[model samples]
Target: MALPIITGFDKGDTMKRILTSIFAFMLVLSLLTGCGKKPVIPDDDDDPIPTEFTAKVIGNTSGNLMNGGQYAEAGGWVYYSSETFDESTLTIATGLFKMKSDGSSLVKLADGAYRSINVVGDDLYALTQDGVFTMKIDGAAGRILPGISADPMGMILVLDETIVFLTQSGEIYRNSIDGKNPKELADVNAYGFYYQDGWLYYGINDASYTIRKVKMDGSSTTDVSTGGRDFVFADKRIYYRNMMDNANLYSMAMDGSDVKKISDVDVNSINTDGRKLIVSSFTGVRVLNFDGSDDTVLSDEYAVTLSIAGDFAYFVSQDFSPQHNKLSLSSGTLENILKVRRIDPQNDVVMGSGISDPYIVRMGDWIVYRDSGELTKGIYKVKTDKTSKTKLIDAYAHNLTLIGDWIYFVNDSLNNYLCRMKIDGSEKGVVIDLPVNDFVMKDGWIYYTDLNEIKIMRAKMDGTLISVIDDSDALGEIKLSQDFIYYQTIGMEAGNFGIHRIALDATRKFTYLDDSIQSFIVDTEWIYYTTKVSENELPMQIVRMNLDGSQSVVMDYFDEYVNVIGVGDGMLYFETWKNEAGSVNRMNPESGQRQLVFTSDLRNDHTVIFENNLITLKNNEDGSVNVYLSDLDGNNRLLIVE
Candidate 1:
């Protein structure tokens, strides 16, 4: 049995305050009446005596509660477990809190690993790392039950005067609210459970992954004959997804009779109001009648964990923030109810090497980059002083470049387009309809390789007067310098890939620079390129030559594969890879002097340098990679995200 560990004010303090105020009022009134025959009444024009006003706490009667043990409402106040995601630890810190339905008078009850709170009459039962505990609704007199095992991932379900819950090892147990005569009802790896009448139905995680039911007296356990990932009990029927059959929704009676397929959509979760079923799928959310007919999609946004309350459906979006939203079933309207503010200190850092362009770029005081987070995989810009950050576009954007007031990028959507938007995230429009492989801006013209046509093309900033610059062979990476457009052409005929350059005006035809060129960058006077010494070896040499193919010289040689990232300030910044480990270094091409800037066990090929700041990806000890910033010489290191 549970015993009170912390005693509260024995219900006398509140009554005493009320009694004291009443006694004071009565004494003043009796004294006034006994001392004088009649007290002088104040005239209407005279000053009036002020009356005292006392504030009172009241319960809400309008707002509905979120459906779960993590959040419950009783007596007009909602108690919930609030969590904060810690990037450093990659975990959530949770605590118990309560607030009015109108989101007022918020109070924190306890701060620790507490969850699965259920309000039974005036007492609140919860599960913590220590054990199952019971407390008053006013957050006092907490005591851990004696015989209950501590299961942090367990849940508490109240049925009549008995409390049912699951242990961490998947054992089901039931006992009185005071924790007397505990009984182990079943032994199975159950992930979820629902209670109805005198029976408990739970979803098991064995080889069959089936749903089973058992009586309240812990006897006659039987399989429900339906397998699924998640099960919801409503309308006296079981609703679940058929994991063995394409993850479609199915429904049946309590006895597993008249089993029917509801829909062929891939359902993520299900919710119900006993009359209507709300289903969340890959496409969006759908509402169906009790018989799974007359289905209508409420919204096309990515929604998860559908919870229906009244005529509204609440869900969390599959976004970077996982924001909470409410949708009206009547009007098909959606509104964001709560926004999770994720202070991603490194949201501006780009950390993947698969992209061919610089994932992170700097323009003046603003840093622009592709957001690698699952929820916000688009182009974003943030101020260097950290004053503001805005998402310029809401798509998988890449190959970022800034030309004047407009920022150009490539969208990798189904219908892919060359996109441009203003620096302030305004005037967004498609520059061209074709998919761009890689692009660079020079002299008010955009040079790119068309993924669909496999040709090097040019177009004005507004997408006008488009023309192909080179179509002799398929183009790979494109670069621009002065009056020439330099690009790599695949070796289709001779099987020897080479670098080629053409004048911007088509006056000079395609001029071959070198064969077996892997990657290259061009400056005003010279072109720097990387080439494989042999057909089977990796890129090992940095060769520099004049624009007209004269004065060719080997600037540097490396045993490992090398890539040139950028060149400035009389130094060349590059990355080298010998195997799984790599390093970023800078060297003077003229002096042949090199200095190691940063070294890591993981690959650091996706890197960019701007304004004396070097940005690259760094792998953490916990198998997670984050973007980091350092000075040009590899000092002042700071993590962007983890």
Candidate 2:
């Protein structure tokens, strides 16, 4: 999903105007295409003949699939966003397409980013970056619905000719199917919504997180009950999973009376078909009576989203390799329906926002990196040209370094430990059984800072020859040179925090090269670092010194604190922050000439210089991080995610 400048009322009002205009334009286009007839409603006689496998898929395909959400399916045809994954961004390109139930006669439906897909009668409704749009089952006469600008959060429900959706800011709106007579139903800070029997049910966004309901005509809004995440109306009662009770299934009467618990396990998602409740929980897929009896486990594999159609319960697996599967609700058998392939990042640009701490390292023809997305954290590798992407490990990994046939990394399990595994992701074991802050490899040995002891330690590749190199408790970043271990240490006195170098064998004591150092990078001939002259000043100077600490010179200075990125192409690349904005700058180490290369809202503290491209890890507004690739001059930017 693209990041929008999310302001409260201003953004909402602006979107309203934009949606009105777009809908007007769509109406004109519809007339020109001879689709000005009333919204088509399938008559009882013309209703799709309910087949034995009449279940239809509905929801956003691309974003939802990546985040484990549902897409659209109906009438023996399944529609979804088929996107190529970009390793740089850890996301997928936006493209919607459809295929037959037998996986034949595939066809393209639309081109662009979309979410919240719903199939109503014989038409499809979806939310895009701009607004809502509707198209026929065959993808013709597509037109945007008017009078809505805020992005919808969950499924778009169409009931009794009225379309209902919730905005990101918790506002719910209702509109006619023809994009007319829109009304603001309620603004109870809602997160999810459902419509049944002339009443709209919604879950609130508050400390108690209660469930509420109101008439479809925007009247008599009242608190229905407390404690639920999502609602599924069935058997004349509203069934929901208790958010305050580990997402266990629960149900209540239409008037929010006679509430009862129906399950004991934690659930990730839940759906019902009047008689039975299908739920995906940590224990696996299970079905139970509406009153929480006769529980039967369907599959041991973790499931994501699920739907019920005829006698089959379809769900996607919640694992590294997500696959769509169908279960025979009666026979209790399971079958594979389709294997959802990971998007290829080279040919596709995927955009998303989130908090991230991605690190990258280049090895042979592949660039291995760790993607720290909230939902899709893992270690992935892609070719230099952004092709042949593969996920080598399905865990949160960092500080990647290649040594011979093994890849050493810090795995964040219970505690951060130095772990090693074959490049093919086999025979994985902890090399250092202690918590480590940082590590570097040299001459078949690993030098690292132990987080638990706060000391510098070393061990062989086979976890032998363990020894403490330094007993300092203030060790910072560690890097290895030819015969010296260069690192930073915090000092008790001002101007004492400096760069120190010691012999690799721990025979020589600490040797100080520069003081008041903020960050530094080691090159073949020079050590590029940032130093603060005083505690009261905001500016920091970029300094370069010969490896032997001779001929020290100031390369450049910035008004804000500077962080050394790396040195490449005869230029020193660094990032500076001012007014909460980050800018990438490069300077000639010899001439001291500097220029701004790129600017962004994200701080570029972690970066890798690969060939002629600079890969950076940047934060997104939606609590995700994106890896972006650009030339040395910050041009020709591309996103690569495996």
Candidate with the greatest lDDT versus the true structure: 2
* Model 2 global lDDT (CA atoms, 0 to 1): 0.63
Candidate 2 per-residue lDDT over residues 479-555, each given as its tens digit: 77677778877657542468777777886755555367778888888888888767856778888888887678887
Worst 10 residues of 1 by lDDT: 1-10
Local distance difference test, each candidate: 0.62, 0.63
Backbone-clash count (model 1): 2
- Per-residue CA lDDT of model 1 for 1-642, tens digit only, reads 000111111111111111111123433442343421121222442221111211121111101111234455667776665554332322234467777754578787776544456776777777654556677777788887665553444456655466667665567776555554466667776665666555677777666767788876677798887556567776777777787787788888888888889898877667775567878787898888877789999888666445444466656665422445668877888876432222222222211111135467776777777764446556777766554777776666668877666677776531246776677877666667566778877656677887756777887766777898877565577777767777777755653377777777755866555477777888778788888777768538998888888688898878898888778677888888887878888989888899998886536336777778877644344423355667888899776543
TM-score of each: 0.54, 0.47
